[model samples]
Target: MSRRKVGLWYRLAAALTRPPMMMLFRRDWRGRHHIPATGGFMVVVNHNSSLDPVAYGHYQYSTGRVPRFLAKSSLFTNGAVGAMLRRTGQIPVPRGTKDVRDALKAAVSAVNGGEGVVFYPEGTLTRDPDLWPMAGRTGAARVALRTRCPVIPVAQWGAHRVLPPYQKKPRIFPRTTHQVLAGPALDLSSYYGRAVTPALLGEVTDVFMGAITDLLAEIRGEPAPAIRQRTGREHPHGLPSVSGRS
Candidate 1:
């Protein structure tokens, strides 16, 4: 598989961040072959830790693909930081506003343009007490179905130990392992060209999230709960409600 083109910003960011990440954690990653060697695709992942994006990006980067992540809009408010994010191909999402459509449209555009787009299907940290994936929003589904692109399901664990949800500081004393598994692209061809409706979107969301939960279960070696815990209201971009969480 040919490597995707890497921009200067992404290259610089990786050079600065990769070494510390390597120093702080060990990796138990698998299923690299599941990521398409060439073409646009969406990576739907389970969100547990704030640090998992770096962890997951490392895994994908190792596969020679640069991933464009949907990040909170506030992160892009800083002038220099925002410029770097835009250059690095990160999509800014404004949660709870009508502007979310812009984010979703950008995601679809990214995929159609032969880039890898990463979506945290839960939109926020797992509200589940056990750190299992909560109910997913339909933003990813909307994009996937809209583009008819391959949606790869990935699951990651252990980054939460380093930086638990909503924590300001990380505990990196003992190096931890970030375990990630990438499953094959989901088979959503049957739903191609179907009318987009709420019920259809919900059904599609379940299919994608179910694939991610199953992969996490494989990583954890445990059965997932039949019912995922509901967190809050969802946006078109799959973000949790903006009242409390980012």
Candidate 2:
């Protein structure tokens, strides 16, 4: 594919991020063709370490698509990091507030206008002791249902080795392997025009989370547990009920 129209800020951010990513991790990306070639779509990815987004973003950028992520509101505070995020089309979500729904509205608009948005369905890094994907909230389902965009489930592993959750020190010497996998756009037309009830959202959320867990299992060459580990702070339509988790 010849160069797709990616923004300068995205290019700059990738440039700034690539060296550190290169020095720290080896990438194993798969099933990228599952991503829509040229249209708006939603990617439901499991979150573990913060570093995984960089790996995931690299995978997206390499495929010639600049991902629009649902970023935490704090990253948008007035500053250079904030400026870079805004210029690159990331959506700032005031995660715990009632107004978090506004971020959903913005995502819907962007998808309808042909942009790929990435959603970390669990809203934060895994609280599962083993880093398995936890129960996800309804935002991913809400966005897909509202915009009727293709929801592609992406599963990733290995970035946590570079920087695990709840820890400040990163292991950079051994060169962690950041594995990412994407699957075909899920067929959710069955739920397209249904009422956006909690039950409906829950069902769709299951599909998204289930697919991610399956992918993570594949990457690790193991079986996902019948019951996903839960952090016990599930948010119906928002971030974690616990403060300072994301």
Candidate 3:
């Protein structure tokens, strides 16, 4: 398939999001060159505040790359909104589906189609009180390995200050500085031929989150905590059973 470019939906989003980003926040975006000019890859980001999506999405878009995200199936099940999401090439994964493989498959397909996909290894806003990246889910590592794509770790901060997770409204006036930094693609060569299991996946997943955390540490000018907060599972109610199995 010919490489897909940004469509009307992305442009519309840019129109709406870029202005507020510019007017309400100062930017410290860096290392955008890490975003490939072409081809398939994964950009795994840390989830902090609710606005991190916009902040991180803008981080990628500003690099002149349109991102294909894996959103909830419900978002694509609506009428007009669903139509637009499909038109925009956003993949939908039915939450709580018995076959989680389907979701990973769709994401891998997106990358193989020459489109970049963004994964939040934590799968939700960090519940960590201080906003450090919690222990990540295996989804990010699974997709990257299955697709054999470069997994670029992206770290972003200051969005939490602008709009704290679950905060009903974002503070607008003071102009918070949203900092986004992109790190080099992770080196997974050591495990290329290893058996695909939860243990191996967990190892790579930790590395993925660590890369983001290291960059975040740089952005914040502090040392990243030595150990990842063992916040079970990516979801609040439970950690997906796939994490500990071999």
Candidate 4:
């Protein structure tokens, strides 16, 4: 399918999905104005629960932007779900591989076509049980560098509290409240047009992760675990640095 058709289908799906989602979470989104009214961009948000994408999707739809999410291939198993994802312009990524050339090309094309792409740099929901963002991976950085699009850091809290991770069921009697905060866009011009060295990539990833951590802290009313302090190194994946950097 063409990008135009995919985006149209995504918009329709989002419209249909948003209303019930709003009712389910009784969502209260703030700083939505921070999202640009028009343009290509990437939204890098912290992951806490499986519902994070749904919450963010609803929020993006409310802001008049149809979101294209990068999801794991496992979630696309169901025929209906896979069809919906395809119609909605979501990309499925194969895990545990460096072979993202195809996914990267698709992402770059989407951004260049003026679509909004949302991804979780952590790659999985937070395992800390407190829902704080874990150290980030570098996939988001690579995309950001490739597209040179504005990267908006979104901090989401209370979703995990709504439906905690590793639980088999969710509580539906009393709807949970969710808060979505959209922060300012990150600047990556310093490394643009240059070879993305390990140090440069780590620096860019830290910049994005720091913003996400700050937003999580704001929502939870407590500081998130410091990345450098806890791990003693940048980035969870430990991507090696090239010569003369890091």
The predicted structure with the larger TM-score, 3 or 4, is 3
C-alpha TM-score for every candidate: 0.91, 0.90, 0.88, 0.85
Which pairs clash inside model 2? none
By descending TM-score, how would the candidates be arranged? 1, 2, 3, 4
User: Tens digit of lDDT per residue, candidate 4, span 1-246?
Assistant: 122333567767766777767677876688888777777889999876777688888888778777889998777777877788877778888876765667777888888888888989877766553456677778889999998988999998666655665454765657777888899898788889888888888878888889988987777677666552232234353422221110
Candidate 1 vs 2: which has more lDDT: 1
Model 2 — which ten-residue stretch has the worst lDDT? Answer: 237-246
Better of 1 and 2 by TM-score: 1
Shift of residue 73 alpha carbon in model 2, Å: 0.1
Worst 10 residues of 3 by lDDT: 237-246
Off by over 4 Å in 2: 1-4, 231-246
RMSD of each: 5.0, 4.9, 5.8, 7.4
State the lDDT of candidate 1 residue by residue for 22-119, as single tens digits: 98889898999999888999999998778888888888988888989999999898888778788898999999999999999999888888889999
What's the lDDT for candidate 3?
Answer: 0.79
Local distance difference test, per candidate?
0.86, 0.83, 0.79, 0.75
Kindly indicate the candidate among 2 and 4 with the higher lDDT: 2
Residue pairs with clashing backbones, model 4? none
